[model samples]
Target: MGTAPVAVPHLPVGSRLLVPVLAATGGSGRTTVAHLLARGLAAIADTVLLDLSPRLASSWPTHLAARRATGLAALPPDQPLTRTAVRAACAVEDTGPHILSDSRAWHAPPLLNLPELPAAWYQLASIGGWQAVVADTPHPLAHDLLTARHTGERALTRDWYELPYAIPVLCAPATADGVHALIRATKTLDAEALPLARTVVALTGTTDGRLPASLRTALAGATDRTAAVVHIPHDPRIRAQGQSTAHPRPRTRHASTRLTDAVLSAAHRMWGRPMPLAPQPAALP
Candidate 1:
């Protein structure tokens, strides 16, 4: 059921990128990877991270509270978000992209009550100076945002918002049901609906560095849409650190350091600059 680039041809200088880390299951570590990608990408280019999901128990913004100047709810729904407002509502990370915290004002349903999402996305896309944007998205908006993209509606206000974006789906590792559930979820987004260039699946929750044969086999069946498959080793530090506010640029724990590197490789591929000799992990089943 569940899930998984790179280039010497990089995005033009100063161009913006959005990498939305999504998940089929609620607690599959989507936010964790999103934060790591944001941090890693920040090392290469100016990055901005938007947390679109507030329902989760923990997130990067929560880990380090001082950076949170405000939440997404404060972005004035009636009008386009002003740059000043974006600054006020988001936690500004000096070394990385700015962050927009999740807001409870989200209303409901298919759109998860945050109907102003499209406009919010446009505002971020419109903002200049940022080279990358990483969004930790929930299930409801995945289809909506990609639908806009497929329909050619998600361009930045200035450049026609054709902002570059990727969708990383994190699925539970080792469980057939989890991968199968992911496969079922993939059925909802056909190749046309999915971001073929940037779509990737990461098998999370692992104690070992390798993935189980069963999970790998399932992912291989999704070769059509997935760009790659990666494994994120489980570490207690990541779990513990989730409770506190994190550095704007994430610092890896003792064991999870390699996990962060693996994720950064994924980020590089999604950005379209191929990693020369980048080791190809196992293919999705």
Candidate 2:
């Protein structure tokens, strides 16, 4: 997707954030959460969404020249990475966030130490002053990062959760599996690492905006876990089958926008106060 990034004489002055959207199960709407989160964050920073998903983000480039953008694997194994290389590998989008996307990196073996290897490029991109990095990392990688969030400590053995104050956004359905996933995810929480003050977005994907009874009981009874659940109603567009039928649909843009707003509201709980969100982009013509 190698479209040049907006050039600046120097790195912008501001804080940075790394949001790796994760999921316990397939239908938890992980990709949807990622794209929406990226869009939501665009208003606050120069957002670079790393599309590590097997499939590309719907808004990313798929054109002739854009498709020629290189993947992470193409990075020189030894030389230091430069802004030019970073710019070359990513594609500029027509609206919202830009994406440093390379699906090939999805198959590489996981690296135990982060801020380097596969993540280094993007991590460096963040360091170079993009301000915000939202990675739609593979589920396995995402889940492993959750382990760091759950324990509040990085395992002595892995690179998970190495990002400072990294926000781990976990998406789950409103079914029995979502409940089971909720319990399994929160079993171990380090107050210092993952606090209960923030909001949790649990997308029910059901007509009624309610979680399953069992999951509700589990979450409600979780006195130690204070992260309140913010339920997202079912949007048929999220579950659409084909590329032609999916997200950004005019019929469901309103629904997706609603969810984006919920995520922004929850963000305030963790980040201290809400950052002004840029207006939602009109659907692509």
- TM-scores vs. true structure, each candidate: 0.64, 0.64
lDDT per residue as tens, model 2, 89-136: 665555556666542433355431223233454355553456667766
Q: Candidates' lDDT values, in order?
A: 0.53, 0.52
After superposing candidate 2 on the true structure, give the runs of residues whose Cα lies further than 4 Å from its correct spot. 1-13, 53-68, 103-122, 139-162, 190-199, 204-209, 212-214, 222-228, 241-285
| Cα lDDT tens digits for candidate 1, 1-285 | 544134333344545455556665666667767666665566666567776654343354444465546566566556655666666676656556566666332232233344434344645544434556666666542344456567877422212123334344444443566677567556645533545444556656545345468767766775455656665656566676562434322324322344334444555665545432212122222
Q: Write down the lDDT that model 2 would get.
A: 0.52
